[model samples]
Target: MTPEFAYFLKVNVAFVLLYAFYRLFFYRDTFFKLRRTTLLAFFGVALLYPLMNIQDWIREQEPMVEVIQMYSAILPETTITPDNVPETDWHGLLLSGVSYLYWGGVLALLLRFLVQLSSILLLARKSKVMQIYDTRVHVLDRPAGPFSFFRLIFLHPGSHSDKEIDEILTHEGTHVSQWHSIDVIICELICIVCWVNPFVWLLKREVRHNLEYLADDTVLESGYDSRSYQYHLLGLSHTNKSATSLSNSFNMLHLKNRISMMNKKRSHGIGRAKYLIFIPIVGGLLIFSNIDAVARITDELVESSFAEALMPEAIQLPIQLFPAVNKEEPAEMHRGYVLSKEELAAIKRAEEQVFTVVEKMPEYPGGQKALLKYLASSVKYPESAMRNGVEGRVSCSFIVRKNGSITDAEVIRGVDPALNAEALRIINAMPEWSPGEQRGKAVNVKYTVPVSFRLANKHKASVSGTPAKGIDTSGRIFTVVERMPEFPGGQYSLLRYLSQKIKYPVIAQENGIQGRVSCSFVIGADGALSDVKVIRGVDPSLDAEAVRVIKSMPKWKPGVQNNMAVAVKYTVPVTFRLQ
Candidate 1:
């Protein structure tokens, strides 16, 4: 996944879990003030938790350890076979649709928020203002609000009796003093971003309700009759069904829950201990957020594994920290794994040596995406190879010097001579890179890339001036078919054909180079063999002979897919046995 998508998922998951914990522990408690603080803290933690890198802090390391970089993925031995419709295209299309839908919802909701906010601002200008002490009250001519927004409260003073006005002002004053509008706005903004997540809506509701609890609790504390205030709120609920979206609405639609909390006995201080749950939850999130740390290991282990993959005894860059011969000082000196002082001195080269890996890998003019785009837009298919329908990936390796100059460009693995030279040309022509760093010092680094050449759906019209007939040019080569293509005369006759047509090279025979050659090819819908290339070669002559024989075969029955002829891929092994 891309970093942006992964971050979106992490943040939403955290929000859902935190909201769940709130409902489970503190939802029913009468600790109105503490509940308000806890909900706000939940929002803070949810937004910031995913960004903390815990591994950087808690990772234990050996003292004086050498931090060599080992990248096994640098030179992969895989072919890149581009299809007519790459799977990535479908994935990108799906992702685009989802992105459009998400942003559309956000924009629509944002427009709604702006409209609601504008309506309030417009009323603040038109309504008659009444300054009661430190508060500014906007008296609307219509039956609207009885809601508090920061220091501004909106309500129609003419709609209520003198006594009711006093109770409404007292309730709204608590909302203003406690800055409850800030909580409402916070929840609304979070809900807008994470509207797809159902749990956030519940969390939003909880936040708004808690603010009401605070306002109601304050009115009861300020010498108001509890029974009369409760009746007044219920009456307001029936008359006013709607209010401002971004403000603290005083509608009593949630009167049942609010009244229950008001009548319930006050929660004891012991209830605060439930908040200890934050420790483990936050700790769990930290463990999850730094999940990439689990893949990290000391380079020493990776180097050992890499050596074993090649000839283990043939090459070894041994590094170990051995203490001086002081008392109680042990050193890391394993048998056969340690190097002598003289051998170490001899192996240690100059600082100018090119590194296979470094503290930071060199970056292309742009990042990986731009690098791919540059290669795609700049690369040209060799006309000779294209005419012959030759296609495969060319794996190349090059060094970026300390001064960011490209050098030592060579194709390590090649499909065809023409394609190999073309791949090298592109690498040599690349612009300078950002030099890699090792120990805060600029250093040369080696980079590798596999450039794929494919003729999956290419028409011969561009190359040979004739359209490719009997060709699909619409889909990928089928690996599985209802009817598999076979050699014209079965396996026995096919072996006889190769034995009679093949000529073992005198030089290879003299050199005793005899082994199996693994080759791949595609049998087109017209039963013509194409896209022939060697997967593994025993010798250059043997590889050529194998491909030549395969390409010269007579037409076989083409593979059938969905009752239609389709191109089928096949892999065959040709062994040269010296008898």
Candidate 2:
């Protein structure tokens, strides 16, 4: 898996665990009330987010064949070739967006509910009154008696002046009125789900402190003397135990901060300034929690698995970033026919024929230069020619005629069309290759040939100009030249047929046109024209005329590669010149 994806998964698991721990121990009071609600929200977001993004994600992973089919419907038949479509990169952005929207809504709802619950608790506490004695406090315990609604004091009874009582009452009442318990509960639950994240723990602590601070500030607003209130708070420092969700009369640990805050004079309007800090902190948390970032991590992991599956045995089982490419037969290979020697030979012969034809053609400008140079030059190459440059061996099968000529050729283990067509064309144009003789007699033999299109030094040339100008010409130019194959009948007959079929200007310029019109065509196993595409147009009229004429031609003897009739790619240049 990709590192990003691994990180995402790890973070998610950690968050959930840490959150669970916090909910169980740290914030059990709030957890009991909202645990189910939080869990339901998380599950709903998870399932719905994935569903919303799956279709788009699938489209991102679509294979090349499917993309070709999609474009084929929109483009002209001749232009519906594989070269027209490109590999698409899936960034996982859409998935992330959907996930963010889902989770954001969940978080918002949870927060809103917590706020409402706090408001309700505060209202209930405000409606009651408590009588204070020297050592104990009493409330008119209702039928719901000693419940969270009634203030239950756990402090030792003590006498207090009017001012001290006012301070104590104001401070404790603030906690009840603001429903600080609810905030503590909500944060604790968040910590449970995000337990693995240290940040969640920090956030939970901050939430608790904020609740205390908010209550302390409210009490100090009641006009009690700061020094006297501080003494009252110190006197009430004895610890107390209260059940979850119950409003306790005393919290000894919080007394110091409560008294200190009351003693400090308020800076004019500091509350507004302090409140502004929430904007960036809360906004950052929301942004980080978005689903897009999570899914990107997942996609990286899946892509890494795909890459590892393609590794060779020479390397370690888990391949690294730069893995060597070698083909090992998968389980399906055992069911197929193991190719024979004769079959392999025929395929090789066909490929040789196609290569020979391409070599004989006029060299492109800066012929031995880089592919980009050849491609960028005024002279255009055909898509079929580009197929011929595909690196690797292709095995095909074909039949030999009584006159020792190759007939039907079919590609069994197919190569890319650009290279495959070149192999087929050469086989078709063979000058009576010796037919296979079985049992010491001339007999029809099935054969296969594996043609490898390796780049040799002789093919390289400078793209910009001569190598003297700092242009590198050390690589062969793999050009896709467009050309019309020499059909059985003369050019004149082909021209006449084209004029009758297509409604376009049909003219054959002189035999030696100043520039060449390179066109690419596919030669099927039956020697019929299948797809004829023009990669780069010469004169618009010339290109149209050339395409029309090339498409309107008779079939030739099929090419034989490996004793099988196979489709071949052929590139020929139609030079229009003043004779």
Candidate 3:
């Protein structure tokens, strides 16, 4: 899952757990102020926790790998036919639809929130403004009860007695002083955006409920008679249909519970200890949220090590075994020798064991070059290994059976544990090879292959230019690194440079071909840019211009992985528009 979706899931899950715990343990308790603080704190932490990268902390404790590597782009093969055409990917479309729906919901809720604010503003303007004690109040012409929005309290003064109005003012004043309307507005907006989650609505209700309890407790503490204030609350709560949803209205909800809570005795200070549970709760969410990040880091480290081993200097394969076995029939037949029945039976028994040497050795469908191509294409450089700078040789042994099927693959010599696993995975995924032959008959053969993990080197030139010696331009380009390669100044400077330097192609401008051309390239460890290719093209002229401008860019600050500069792949969009 993407980090954004994971963040949403984590926040919702945290809210569910917190709200459930509050209802089960503390909702009925008379710790109103503490309860209010806890509710807000719960959501506040939830909002910020997902943004923290705890994976790095975990990575520091991990043992460091001893090797690092760099990589280059593998040139595309030009043997495409109609049968090799790609199929449409429905999973990408599904994900896009989900993203669109989520943003649509958010926008719709934001629009509703704006509409509610406008309505509240309109009501405030129509009502007459007056000073009641130290607070400025809006006396509504309609029958909406004693509600407070921010600092302004709205009430129908003519409908209540002077004493009742005094009590009502006290209630609304507590809301304004405590900024309970801020909590209401916050909850309203969160509930609107997260309308799909039931727990969010419950948490919203709990926030408002706790605020009311707090206000009621404050009035009782200030010497108001509980019985009289409760009576006033019941009388004023005539279900004002015109009451603003976004305001903290006096009789908003849970009248029975508020009255009961008013009569309950205050709990001991030890009740506050329950709030400490949030520490572990938050810790758990942080760990859970970073699980995918940890996996990604581990993968990078493995891939980095493997990429380094891909360099020619690191390849230590046993060349003696790799010499092509004589595939053609031997030039001369050897003299035949007679054997006893017992000797033939012993030879047959030993035939099950794999032979290291045969007249004709097993071969891949095409040749050794084709085998290397398959390995290069099939191997997925692990991101974790790249980040950790883990590089080494992973020697794997497999059996090429009489039926030309690969089997019994095992790692004989290992380097980094992650790289070893990845090497084994690639070997196991290989297609069938030609069977080895002995005495003109197919036989099982054991083969050992060593995959080197070495970091790629710095190149001194661009793709359409000559490179310095000793750089093998094989291996796929990497898209991520510890620190991404950047232009000398920064992103804004790079954008400015592109704006000034890039000119619209005349053919594109005349044909009205105005679209973004996405160009991908690899920045070598030496910071020289290479492999500039247009990944998504608008027109031939535009594509060529984008590639040309990319080629003209100066050396970038090379990308780093495992404290070593490595070849990193980057993509940029160059747009051509008609003026």
Q: What is the C-alpha lDDT of each candidate?
A: 0.66, 0.40, 0.65
Candidates' TM-scores? 0.52, 0.32, 0.50
Write model 1 residue lDDT over 188-212, tens digit each, in one string.
8888898898888888889888998
Query: lDDT winner among the candidates?
Result: 1
- Roughly what TM-score does model 1 have, to 2 decimal places? 0.52
The 10-residue segment of model 1 with minimum total lDDT is: 309-318
Greater-lDDT candidate between 1 and 2: 1
> What is candidate 3's lDDT per residue for 510-534, written digit by digit as tens?
7756654556888997789998887
What CA root-mean-square deviation does each model show from the true structure?
A: 21.7, 24.8, 25.4
Write the number of the candidate with greater lDDT, choosing between 1 and 3. 1
lDDT of candidate 1 at residue 505, scale 0 to 100: 77
Q: 304-360, model 2: which lDDT tens digit per residue?
A: 222111111000011101001111211100101122223322223444231111102
Could you give me the TM-score of model 3 versus the true structure? 0.50
Show model 1 residue runs off by greater than 4 Å: 61-88, 131-135, 292-579
- Candidate 3: lDDT of 80? 18
**Residue 248 error for model 2, in Å?**
6.7
- Report residue 490 deviation for candidate 1 (angstroms): 42
